[model samples]
Target chain A: MKDLVPERYALAFRLYPYARSPDQDATAPVRHKAIVVGGGPIGLATALDLGRRGVPVVLLDDHEGAGLGSRALCFAKRTLEICDRLGAAAPMLDKGVQWNLGKVFHDDRLLYEFNLLPEGGHAMPAFINLQQPWFEKFLHDAITAAQAEGAPIELRGRNRVDAVIPAADHVTLEVMTPDGPYRIEADWLIACDGARSPLRNMLGLGFDGRVFEDNFLIADVKMKADFPTERWFWFEPHFKSGDSALLHKQPDDIWRIDFQLGWNIDRAKELEPARIRARVDAMLGPDVDYELDWCSIYTFQCRRMAQFRHGRVLFAGDAAHQVSPFGARGANSGVQDADNLGWKLALVVQGIAPDSLLDSYDAERVHGADENILNSTRATDFITPKTPVSKMFRNAVLTLAETLPFARTIVNSGRLSVPCTYDRSALNGPDHPEMPARTRPGSPCPDAPVGQGWLLSHLGQGFILLTIGLDAPESVMAHGLTVPRLALEATPELAARYLGGAKGAVYLIRPDQHVAARWDHYDADAVAAATARAIGKE
Target chain B: MLITTPNLTRPDESYARLIATHEGLDEAGSHALNARLILILMNHIGDDAVLAEAMRLARETGTEAA
Candidate 1:
């Protein structure tokens, strides 16, 4: 941590964000041609992805900069694979705290502990927890740097969006700029606006979903404790009247605790410091001292938009769905929404693919949104049961799980993330010799090593030809696939683990990284035929 | 068997009795009613597509005029 960041960059907190106009008073004319309303991680990730592809984007946020709050931290192996595809992987790895095991507790009892690193390939490359603002700042810089190189994603900090109007073909956005109300036009509009999306409601979309009665108070503090810094330590729920406590580490030895407020506490009193101190005191022995850095209250909601598109106007991230921040899905899935949309928009803008290709965005991501909502709900339900009988049943099962290996696997798979398979989709291959239970062809492209670079499942911008063999086996040939980009690669270890070393296979992967098709023998003839049919090349 | 129709599927007839809020409902009452409505709808649609689409549409403008 010390060696990677330079002293000049260490003072980054003070030098960056370059204070801008107050969102409420200032009124600047239209600054961005296509404005992104929120500057959270998803919005910034979207800005970076688009800026790199020569698309000018305007990112606006009311905050002077990214929030100082420690919101989301965990990154899954799947997410890291996506990050690697977007060129944000290296910095993320350098700045985060990594862990690969998940533990569960039933009151004072340790119910189960499953080590995930081994399951995801010894080093797994998963679940990195970093301060959300750090990534926000990193992405903001990435966007600026991309602009300096060529096309930059325009950023209008401390600016607020008051109106959005979707018209024929192009969408016009009326923004309450630092100066006066200004309007801008774009070929498309996306509401990465967030859960309280004014843009969503302005469109009359029903945010039909469940809001858990439970509330949580998250406090960031600098503390010294004997608990291992790597695992999510869960305090006994019963000891704290059925609330859970978390210990997450940030840079500079700062830790964040997400204190799950009991159902009985008044929502208004959830943020009182005395209530927070009491919870912390319960967790500590008589001696350890900790200083509170910051605190906030948040409730959990599990909901997704009924549709991701309203004509040319689209919604991504929080603007589209809100999940309990339990299994690291909220921000990760939202960033993924940006990655999925960036290339689709670029291709359509460049006249490479018909605009209808955007339909695939909704087709794929809405499903992914469902998956996130479900996972977050499962984690939440397990941590906080609704009824005493269900709590007792959950505890009994968890207790039984401690002695049973198979049962623990079932529980951990949902919480820690099993590899996502896109089995029943239009993009996958017909039948292949190398298809394994885990490697179900259309599933998210599995990780493999190709020379100095990592061969990942989720390619950011275009279709990829992942040919696995010792020396480019010539089996997976790309001939008629004409969407964005394609590439070929291999690794001995990946072949053994995922592809089962059948002299490898050729995988025609889509821009979203779902395998379009794969074959043991790559006759440019057959591969080309499959690619044509998959992308409607006929 | 009824497949989850996603965006195309609305709530069943029985769900009409459940409202976003009941008379004299406080925050808790409103939230509970909302949850019941969602559960009923989810049980019918099964797939999340419809709600995801609704969210996207709503964000495009404002609270759905429906």
Candidate 2:
């Protein structure tokens, strides 16, 4: 307890340390193409996505690197896929503990076990349990490599944004560093400053949502034990540790344990090492020796801004929305927000796409935020049943889940994060009704083994004309933009995922690998119109 | 789904069994038993439309009788 330095400063690695930029010494405020505030997972990923697209972007953070503690442990398949696009998923998958099986328990009996990915042909697993620090570290490492390859990215540490002024076209910012305060401007401002977003507050925006009346003690413990890398959850645990408990294995030998420490607990007393160890002792028995790596008491709120985009400024990640940690939706959804916004912002900045394309970012990400909020809230309600009837129903569901397959579906031990399909998005183009719904308009392109590589690997960050069992021109010109064709023979996995009853389909995929439109065969006029609608030109 | 007329041929036997299930239970125990019974019955009546009708009828009849 004596060494109380923040985890960001105490990590084994030092990221972008505070350094004076040329903008700091300029005579007047320097205006940049894109300025991202906060160097968290969402911020860094956003900058990386934009930078890789040849957009000059700067990321400003108050800290040098990720703070201490294994904050977010579960990165879903969709998150890994997004990271794959950013050239960061390799290290994450290499270092992360991948698991698709999860076990749910009631009292001392096992209720049921479920596998997230039963039929798998995808490149990434169902989920990976990597500590948040490592997740951000991988993104930073990728940024470093991308910079070496001449991707226009500049990371500034210990630079806190003091103020932001938004006008019709650009945004003005006052940044404070260790040396002093300086003024800068950005054509577009992105706020990824986490849950308690100071930037959101500065802009006088309201992040309105419900806060559950409960507390959770998250303890990351390091031990030499042979626990399988699977997620184990308990309701009314037999050990009497708490109301509910969760155990997961991370990359290192460290295991994460979360105990639901009901509302109205002593903040200082509960944090005592002996008190926390008592709960751990009860769970692990007397023989297993373990050391507490880090622990914290967190009370979560399922919240989001009214709208993600406000004029010239955009909010992303926890700055735009927040959810309970039960479903691991927090960081996963944030990275998706970066994925959704990057291409649109890039096109808009390059003058290829109209400004209305950015509005779809607000429309689509707000949709994503709502979906995450709904799922996490439902999971929270089931975890902490407020009323006696709710508790009884929860127990009843658990009771029946032990033997009945139907009852098992009722049990909600966190729905877990899944990619959201913008079913009703304004940017969505025409959908082939005969095609599989999984790869319809507004859905993320399902990855399937293509040739030696994967389907998603070929949908390189641009408008793609993906043709299956058909021939198309090398590229089609649409609204002064080129849509290259990636031809492939219809494999069984691809047929099942992309082309259902339809024969020889042509798909118009957005830059973020989302299906915009599909047809039985290529028609240059139809593809061009769909491309126009996909980018909000319609 | 909510049979206004008698559907169970052995209605008395069924009522007797229901009463016997709560014989030795205290107030809270009886309440818990009733909850379990409701869930079991809900599972038996798998159709959501039928269950909704029964639920609505129960609410309507309870308010009228009270």
Candidate 3:
């Protein structure tokens, strides 16, 4: 059993070896409040969120801990913010290399550069580049600390869920462990298994979408160099290793280089260390010295399941939707999924809200998945043109982009991932026209500095009524829920973000820090209705 | 708003100039020039509604001929 565990997990943290729980010896399967499968970033985060909310959750994983390779390297600002709320962002931000600038190149010439966050008073940077394993490791560390503090989060390693039987009220699962198979039931099951979701397959679901006819080889090389920490992408690179290449800096002086190897290549030969070193040598020239750390060839698809939720079973992360890795949306969006589902699922399990509230998770996340697929597909099309005419247009845009500023907008290396706004969600409540559109209903609450702490830190784990320059009750009880009021004097940044031209404003922020409703001024009835509507009462 | 009804004054001159701009270009160069010209014009017609209407008309004209 120990041999099956990857060495990477041993190198980093203690593995969660399978332990004999009493459920295995029970005559009847014991029921859990929430059961999350696949202890990747999404599952770990979901369990952590639920446990923090006092919901007993058990996470099952086939592997002991994080797998090999630095798969998902770019953690966006929104993901960091979500991690911050989960009490795991400090280690990530400390270890991950932060960068906001990206430069695009054609052959040997630099076309233009972009700053993801041009202006900022936000707490987190635009993005941070960290190895996926380290990202998962930090989450595990936070979970360990939470467990010490008596958070009811249990992680079962080597517990592979084999079969799922979903009933109206609970979902039964047959989990395989080193000790043998055990039966358990969960009120709600979250499948965060991954792009090739075994649970999704077990349910006989369809993952339908376009399969791009291109391949990329990621080679993480450890080296000591003084290259600026920024994303550099090249089209028709001068190195002649591939059609396109991307270079990014990661923690521990390791750099990630991706070469776009076209379809119909020998996968085994391309992964050979000698071949990979040759490509690296060409890209780096002779002066730079580096050691190859890890290499893998990947073929991506822009595909997703028809629906994220079915009966009592829910899907999150790559198990629900998938997109090309160009924009670094995979793990980032997965973390966002956990953030969105955590509070709602907790409420439903606690009987504070009806099961209908979970439907909003499906609606909002599906909206986010579609937006990610569209952007990544467009970026893939630009990077790998399917037709001669399309290639001509892409090259023309690149050529013009060298000199003209307008053409720069058309050049798409990869539109980096950003938070998705559920603009048309049914969960959205009233919006004040005078308020800024960026913070409208269904948008994530923009963070601002307030009294030596950030505004987002003030709004966590429950619904908040953030009133600025207005008088409201200390708390409001509506529909069997208590909405706490966070009154503050309007600061410059807060006014710009939450209150545009409006003199005073009131915002109803959901547990996930997304705005559910807003108004020009505080009203008790409006607040009650919006809070009810946000929980899917309407 | 997109003006499909005789919006351009001196239509002949405009057409002549468009043709004259590609006088010395090869097939690939001519195609690139046309793409650039289309991009510039699309930027000038920044309104999404107007640009979409023009794009639909352009595609429909090709399909109609086909």
Candidate 4:
């Protein structure tokens, strides 16, 4: 067993040693169907999704275990559903703090509280707050279990990719291990190597965007407190004069607190245990007993590479783009990136789809990144107003929110993460009238309770033809379409949400559960054409 | 379009409410609050042409006072 993780942090999963050191097999380069660099949540998810699709994947990571701290603590509902599909959400939900309400305060007075998920009947909550380490552990365990069950996923710990050479057909990687260095060839290379992506640098990709001038001090503390498991954000909190503070509860009696520090503050002094303790004491009152678990000072940047795809080398997660953590978009979007790329890459690797299908991943995720960046930038601007005028405007909005309903609309204290809809993709079939706008082409199929399971649970893993309140046309079977067709009775819930005012509908859904296209009536030709377009055959 | 004349039903009451909203503020704070109020009103009346005309009228009237 490799003892590579920090002793202070618990390692809940086993770390596998690197395969094929220089001494073991130096002459012949081992070839893999896909190689995912970085063993973070995104990389693990990509590998897991590919392995589940029967694609042989080799995952490399420089570190031997999970991340050092509770890096990204909030897991959005979409992300949880994606994890559930990958067989990792159960443990996360079981050991995570589930909450939907968030309270925002201006000074000591409470401004307002918002409910993320007011209605029920969904499989998961709006969000789950779990330590990133535990989340990664759950994913790691899922990958290990899948491998045990004959899934072709190879997790290589302490395997660092020193160099990347992109060829016409494949990518070559030089990996360094404890024993020595070895080379490997991959048909497709996925870079999930995080924000400071070494693979991105080796490939000479440029990441351009703005880096905010503000810094934040984050401390994860364990204490027994009666605070509710809800998100609390304070602007100019009395404890932290002229600054903002955020408090969120996690499992294991841990609370994550973030304090906004001006740009000129000393990072070292802010991170000191004594200073952190002082701040915590002031915030929680002098008598509260707590122990600091981890502390770090971070500056956020909103940036991305111009292109996520470079020939056979693809980028996902932080390696591809970065955003301020204000909106919890970082890890959530990365997970979505993995989910979006996994099935497309599987089809391409299996030679079932043209390589051009992978282009849709770039198009879709770049759109997603832009949305995340835009929302995060707005939240950051509102939280840390740079100019006096902007600050005054923000303060005025905060003031007016107490009485004016319209003013509350402009209050942006980190708009929570929601899955982006790929509304403008070229793969969507023609739109039809009398359909609900929410379930239109390129949008995620909203989950609703079916007979025993949710609607999302019934779709995906391949092209699915969902016919509601209608019989499958013989033309669909006559065409010998490989897409699985599921005929569902139009229950009231499904009818209202999916069918809308239409009596019936036929929906062609992508493998990632995004609605590729929908029509009021069954049209085999349209479905066939949309399927082809979806696989980049057109 | 821009409201060139007073449009409030009770101009004095509205003015008093506006002043009351900035009761505890000093001179600089009052000016800041007024600037913010203008921005909020501008956002509410989103028509650019109306905003431009209102700005022009305010500038002209202030110049005449000067």
Candidate 5:
């Protein structure tokens, strides 16, 4: 037995130390008090988050081993920051290739490369590309460290969970381990299983959305090129076809190419490596040679769970939605799901906040998932160039875009984000203007250089007040906003950005970086009222 | 490579760019700042709405959504 602190935060499933435990009997399948099924990024992140918080959890996965496969190459900056908070970010930072710009090309000729990283206040480069295996190893190590520290994350790898049924207080799960059948009970269950999540199906949840007719062949190829490693896309990309290839560097020498085979090609035959290789060889030129590392045929799909939660059993990652990877939504969104749920779940499991606080998880992240689905679909539509009319239009747009600065900027910006906010939600109100001609409440916050640290570095794990003055500058702040969360008034150096030395602006910020509300002057009443709404006090 | 510049490390040119992203600047000030920001960020990486969103989200919500 280990100490209470370590016992509370151990990882659950999917990964186990290769070394035999100092205790010989560790191989026996011990019944867990809480269970999380599936060892995908979402599941593993959840398990690690739980263990770190001292929650006894059981993790199960059907995979033969850890994520050794090649998949999702571009890990977004936001995801890195989230992982940083989870304590796995440092290793990830070192392992992946930080990228700032990506170029688009057609027929080996230049089209446009979008530069993705520049700051408002982001901590890392916009995104990094690495083989999923390398990143997975980093996460696996983090989970093990958290577990060894005594929050034991018990793993039952090669274990397929046959069924999970939620009872009033706990979940009854039937799992088939390598050693055979066993029944386990846990106080709560979280199904982070992927798109084929049996757990969600067993619960009778509907996975609803459109499955794209387009088939794409994604191949990891060893090719030497003079191209920048940071470049990600190529418009009119296919050589045999009009233009439809997206190429990106994975690590350094390895590049990934996703070639659209169109709706007409047999999804099976078009994806066969031999078929794909024949096409790749043609595109690279008759004389050029490229070696293949791994290949897979993919179909872009837009889908989401009808419900994220039913009582105690919850869902995250691909279990909730499967967006196309175009905007790097699938993996990036999953990590965000883990970040959002991790803290709230810990608080709920520890009895810090009311369980209802957990409901906000669905409210916040589901909306984001919906937004991402829309963005990815748009990106898919823009780049697809499938229909003859659409292809012609896309070609015209791209050709004209090169000559026209405005069009190029628009296309470029579409790759980046527009300031989006959830200010429209019930949590966000109409007290201020619909979008203050300038400062919209609940808008995405940009990064600002502030004293001691960048203002953003100060925002992890709590609420913040961006008022014109100091932390206790206003007489009203001395009384505190009605919102129950912690509020740290920014310093005088940074205070000028919000409300300042003058009758300046004041903003009530939520932990997730959505502007709850803002005002030009310090009105104790308005500030308190806005704060109340922000923390759901109203 | 990613460093948070504390306030206006160089106040002469940066003051206008800083004002536009946070609060409203007057016509001349806003135009000048936007142009400078466009030039500044274009050289590094195109800084646009995503940057605006992160800033607004951080300032308004107090905690970073990222």
Candidate 6:
């Protein structure tokens, strides 16, 4: 019998002694402005955002280092932009495989290939495939640097939360450390703990959704190959008797392969080294040299908590929701949740915005989670039909998609993750006439080349006014508003895209680079009202 | 310009009734029922040109799986 391959991702685990160990003389619990649990991508990103905003934060994680394997290998463009804002995108872009094209196959025949981003004006590409461990390591390094720079971010590893007590104004936590147990208090708690969140369990929250019966075997293998860096998905491939298979390339010559195993297959038997070797040997020619890096089996699920916010404790990432891995929505949506929550929490902590502003976080992210769940459920249902008629329709769609353009719309393997627009958000202000629909009130600001850099590089991290074809008002700064105004040169491309021949157009953009409002003329009172609405004061 | 703009007033109730019609049938039986319903609805419409236009509109506004 062949020996099973051991997991090979190397993560350096560092242990830190408990800083606030209990003493003989009783002392007041150390208070933090914000306490973030779970040091994964979402937690680290939230910590970085809060620290950059000068909000003191304490981050806790039970584990000492990165996760075991390359769990989430795809980072969407919006997520990379969020990471870029937090100062961690350069390492990811340098070490990740950037791919924007994908091919889908039905058995031996090729169905179609798609290009996610056909236009290339944006700074970030449509997608990058980097191992989850490397992504976390980059985030960790950023947090360390921020701490050194007096950002007041204390990352505590090997500290587990044993109890959670919520109050009207604060949340108390009982943390277990390497030395002993200690208690901590915080004005707000952000839970980024993963799918099986201990904090969520202690709070008695339940996820309300469906659990799929199908199981997928994921194997990461390292090999030197010349295959192009594009996603390849097969339905009932010739080498495997399963319903589906997926192949994706990651950084460092590692490739992720997923094979569908129907509901009743013995998972233990399927994971054996000999059986996995046979499967790999049949799929790739038997002569290829490869080494298994990691292997695991997972059942797909589409579930989420009814609400992500509970008083002072807010949940982000997999702790708040879980989706099937097909669409890459799990970690991507979590990062977006962090991005949305970070700015709002910072403002509230600094007393610049009221706590009611956090309600929009729940509303917007609930909408985002529902969107992810809906897409994930549809993709899973298409991939694994429950009824015979459903299966017939799915097959018919795939077969017809080969020649018919309309039928191609129904062929869904996975929709892939895209940023969600909060159009119905209550914080959105009035829209102006003749402006482009793409940059509507709740939409993220579209990136354009401004001189030598992208437009988004100049916008986010604070409220700003973008004026096109107009001069800034002389009294605009005296309105007691803290917004910085930028006047564009009305270049032909900018005017055509944003102004649409309407001169003197003004736009109010939020700290997260989402459009708050736009007007053909600037009114200081109106701008202040719009800014107030954007911060959830109205 | 838009003819088929939410004609059904009580869509949720109508949907429940429509699904209830196929409660106990097998795959082929359910498909036959669907065919029969389509024929009945087509006859109710009664105009051949309108039916053709409806078919074209339905085919044109293809369902996005996402």
DockQ of each: 0.02, 0.53, 0.76, 0.33, 0.02, 0.06
lDDT at A252 for candidate 5? 47
Lowest summed lDDT across 10 adjacent residues in model 1 chain A is found at A3-12
- Candidate 6 local lDDT, A459-510, one digit each (tens): 8768888898677663244223478887787765567667874776889888
Top-lDDT structure, candidate number:
3
In model 2, where do residues sit more than 4 Å from their true spots?
Answer: A1-12, B1-16, B48-66
lDDT of 1 by residue, A298-327 (tens): 887999888897787888988899998877
In model 4, residue pairs whose N, Cα or C atoms come closer than 3 Å (at least 3 residues apart or on different chains), thus clashing, are: none
Best by DockQ: 3
Comparing only chain B with the true structure, the TM-scores of all models are: 0.45, 0.90, 0.93, 0.85, 0.34, 0.81
Candidate 5 lDDT score at position A2: 29
Ranking, DockQ, top scorer first: 3, 2, 4, 6, 1, 5
Question: Residue-wise lDDT of candidate 5 within A107-151, one digit each (tens)?
Answer: 455656566546544466677887776666677788778877887
Give the clash count for model 2.
2
**What are the per-residue Cα lDDT tens digits for candidate 2 across B1-66?**
656787898989999999999998998788777877888888888888888999999999999999
TM-score of each: 0.78, 0.96, 0.97, 0.91, 0.73, 0.87
Deviation of model 3 at B34, angstroms: 1.6
Residue A213, model 5, lDDT? 76
Better of 3 and 4 by DockQ: 3
lDDT at position A483, candidate 4: 86
Best by TM-score: 3
TM-score of 1: 0.78
The best-first sequence of candidates by lDDT reads: 3, 2, 4, 6, 1, 5
**Candidate 5, DockQ score (0 to 1):** 0.02
| Model 6 steric clash pairs | none
